[model samples]
Target: MNQFDTSITFPNGVTLKNRLIMSPMTTLQSYYEGTVTQDEIDYYTRRVKGLGAIITGAANVEPLGKGWQGELSVAEDDKIAQLSKLAHSIQSQGSKAILQIFHAGRMTFPATLSGEQPVSASAVPAEHRDPNTHDAVPRSMTNAEVYATIDAFGDATRRAIQAGFDGVELHGANTYLLQQFFSPHSNRRTDEFGGSIDKRYTFIEKTLESVFAAVDHYADRPFIVGYRFSPEEFTNPGITFEDTGYLVDKLVQTKLDYLHVSLDNYKRVSIADNYKNQTILKYLHRMIDNKKPLIGVGGVRTREDVQNVLGSADLVAVGQQKLVDPDWPLKLANNADDAMINDEFKNAIEYTPLNAPLYDFLVERYGSIPNI
Candidate 1:
């Protein structure tokens, strides 16, 4: 049997139809008010046919957590209708829909939150790699506000269940609020949510408690819950592979269905000085040791790449390739590689389902998303 066509079941008894998943990439196509636009639905509908599951781009759990313009939101109950449409669209093509939820924390801007300052574990400002961009120093989140944010994550999970999604992926990666609380660089608090690494992980622990409470109460059937995280950060005192090991150890003890490590390349080695020898995916695979399925992503554009990633990971997730060729898995299944888009395809927009906004975003930042 084709390995990619084999079904894999998670620890929670939720099984994926295949070993391929669509990485959650922001569309920049949602409405200004955070509602799901038809453009977003059409974009997902076009890409779901041959995947096991599709994770939607981060949806802010609260208004102040909005990361950028055109982001999706699960903050209010009214969004359920449109969100249901999105879930239905993906599942219509046989892919399980997973809602990726997050709070941007210090990664957001005041303008994006309508003049309100962003909040984080500490009043730390994010380091911007781009010289032209200036970031604001976020205000420290009050103890009460911190608890509220945790509750907000739970609320978002409940909304995902109401929206008919098959699962929810906590957007703990990407320097978002969850990562902010876990990173020593972003979390300098002397209180319960910071100080030691265990304290720094308190927010996530409590969050898992809250999220599972919702799952226990609301989910009528087996519903997958996954956590996505970066293995390390480039900043001094930022998250290290060691720190991620600790985090992963804690997460595996929870009811999480899987662990999704975010990376630019599936086989990229560790960036930390002492751990630079091993590929992050392989390192994680050894650490996880089949405790739960690990989803590895990055630069998977072809059948060989898919098989290579699946060698280390139980599932392979495609990011930019999905943008260039939404029907990649379908074509691969039919042995139609000759018809697939190549890196030289400059007019990909004319052939793919990329809406104007996402197409423009990819073109403007072509360096990051190869083969635009």
Candidate 2:
């Protein structure tokens, strides 16, 4: 417990109260135009009291990049005020808030953003059929368009700072825009932005550099910049753990704040189903040893499961479990013996609307929810 009580420090001298981080999990409850709503402010603030730092759900960088209905966006200036309110709410509760900036690429459907054609590294269509609705194949992005996309990330990062976030996290995992460029199966470009492994990473490298530069100039706060990257493409051949290691090694030299290591992109249904496998954490521990702060996330359900990887990783991230119990970090920190999943809370999450009422209700009642 002594080691666990030790303070956790991120790059740029940002220190957290503890090592329990609330991982970024998407909640599509924002205004259709992607503005932050009052419900969102309440939802995030509810969990801020007992956590180290909170990484927000995916915030689209551009309209065409949106992947879900009601998801928020940081692309526009008007949204900054709402985002600022959300950040202040979390900070008031004593938790640092990091906005997760993302572009969905081909995973976006036309229905989400006014029939706009989705863009990706290459023209390859996604293999999985849409759960919500059938959609058209996405078009491959041109070289110029790729560079423009990088610029969009920079713009979004600047906007996040304006909105009062403690930092910004580049969403590079789950076969999204950034991951699309990293996968050999997805990125078939022969240009400098693709081809060899080093070339394939050019877009992500450039995006990070550009965003860092923007944040450096516009914001005076000690901003932290980290990345969420997939270490492997489980369903795709030629994309193995070794290849991911090479990519991570390259990113380490970029002098970023943290590295969030995830195993498979969300497109892989089989791997997504078996997330509790301890082997994923073991592999991540072996791949990254640079002393940089690392956050490991998968299907972690119990407190012991989190403690098992405490020394091996800097932060233990829980998504589904947290949805079932927002007080999960508090329970684990205090070593409560009776912490268990509230089935009612789980059912509530399905209809929770991704806003404050649900979270506020949970905070008001900290016991297991009886079935309605």
Candidate 3:
């Protein structure tokens, strides 16, 4: 049997329809104020069909956490009505809707956060999303702010449950706040949230503690929770291969639904001496072997690419390819002919929601997003 055609149940008793999932990709379709727009609803509704689960673009858990212009916001109780619209849009198509939650940390702009200085583990600066404030230096978050962020994550999860989402994926990857705390290069503090590798994971552990507590209290039926992380960093003394393994070990023990390894190429291996030859996905797979399922993503475009990733991971997720072909999984299930697949690109323009930043991003940076 084709691996993609099969269903798998997680330890949480939540079962996916098949082994294909929709990876979260920012559409830039929300209101600048962070409300879910009708266009955004239409955008996701088109892609949610046929996947086992669709993880929505990263939504900020607090006002100061917004990373981009159109990022979705879940920082307050009032957002539930609009969030429910999003949840209904995806789940109505029979696929599980999982909201990915995040705090941008130093990746955000001061203008985005209403004049507040961006907060991080330290007063470090990196390339940010806004060109105007690419050089903005963030302040170190106080201990109270740290705990409040953790609480915000829980409140956001509870909001997800109330909004009718099937699950939530903690956005701990892509150099966001969670990864910032875990990276030695970024987290040079001497506190419990930094310094040692074990201590670096304390924030994530506490965040998950709050998340699972909300899940236990709010979810009436089987709900899934997942965590995504980038494997290693290019910076010196940043998250090393060993550090990633250690973090994954701790994450798997939490008994979340699955662990997602973020990669630019699923087959890309480490250049570091410690992890010589094997692909990073395979390296991480070994660490979580028999412990929990892993979701692999990267340059998965065609059926061949899909199967290649599934070989390394329990399930395969698509981001750029999903933009090119929203109905790709459904077409594969029917064994649709090449003519149908080729016609997909022509229809893709309709599926890809139009937003100025998303349009420019597709055209400029990721010229790989096919027909835009």
Candidate 4:
């Protein structure tokens, strides 16, 4: 490998060809039952030709836990077989395969969950409105239900490993299930799972412990475990960089293999805040020590940005940038001059009202659309 080569070797001896990971994007492309289709396999395999590991779209663990209408799921035994096939397709190209496991919490729409209200740590609704429908109120998860959800996450991890995934990523960021527990604005519970900082962290601690135990017992290979966390919650009274640093300290002591850091939970900001801006990446680099591998994701678009962060962090996650060009990592690694993105990819990266119409047409014909 060259000196500037981005390939990284995980603890389990899986060698990533490059440090560019395809971050999970909820593209509403899977079937209603969340089965991976042939088109889905082809979409992911095309991206794996020149990337490191392909982190799959967030796979919901429970049906009621799903956040969107067409979100993917690995909650059932039958789904595992198709997911295994998806993993095999990526592995055939010599790329590691990992799945992002998530529960959308208050972010879930009632229509998505069969008219059942979405659940969260408390009765707090997501600060933002649903893209499809304008609703504010969301249901809350009971203490016992929270515990059950934690177990569900562990079960999902076991299922992912059984399906031949190299590892699983706990979706702790983006104001989802774990983020709902961590944010004071979202988690209003006064019980042990809420209140003080330590109390709020209890859910994540327990979830991580359960997931690690599940992998230990069920996974045939030494599965890699990691969490995607917000370096700074952008809402008022939300988690700050310092709070995330403390969380990182606790997580580093666990069996986690990497930390995927990003910014989320904003009440008011442009869509760019959710995707662009390199400031968050710099802050994340400053917050974390050199203990575990740190993966940074934001508006990173160029090779120079990749190299700058690579000097400090272990990996650079390309989200919208890769949506335009599946060969992004290869182009950067080879130092191509005309690697600038085109209009199509740029438009796809941004949120457009027409996306829904286009997606509806694609799903009708393809049976599923590939979430970037």
Number of the candidate with higher TM-score, 1 or 4 = 1
Model 1 C-alpha lDDT versus the unseen true structure: 0.89
How many clashes in each structure? 0, 1, 0, 0
- Which 10-residue window in model 2 sums to the lowest lDDT? 264-273
Regions of model 2 farther than 4 Å from truth: 130-134, 263-278, 342-372
Which tens-of-lDDT digit does each residue in 148-170 have in candidate 1? 98999899999999999999999
- Residues 1-372, model 2: lDDT tens digits: 214445777768888777777788766668889998887887787777677788998999988889887787998889999999999998896778899999999888777769777888877776665534446467788888888888889999899899889999899988898988888877888888889988988998899888988888888878889999876675564356677778778878786888887632212222443344546555566567745778776666576666765646777666666676677777766777376564555455655444464454444444553211
Candidate 2 lDDT at 245 equals 72
Cα-based TM-score, every candidate: 0.95, 0.86, 0.92, 0.86
Tell me model 2's lDDT, rounded to 2 decimals: 0.76
Best by TM-score: 1
Whole-model lDDT, model 4: 0.75
Give Cα-based local distance difference scores for all models: 0.89, 0.76, 0.84, 0.75
Query: Top model by lDDT, which number?
Result: 1
TM-score of 4: 0.86
**Candidate 3 structure lDDT:** 0.84
Across residues 1-372, which tens digit of lDDT does each residue of candidate 4 receive? 122364677655666777778887766667888888776777787778767788888999888779776667988888998899999998898878999998888877778888787888988766666434435566677788988989999999989988999899999988888988998889888998999999999999999988988988998777888899866665777876667768988888887888887532111122233434445555455556666778866656677666765755788777766665667777876788386564554354444222453245444533442322
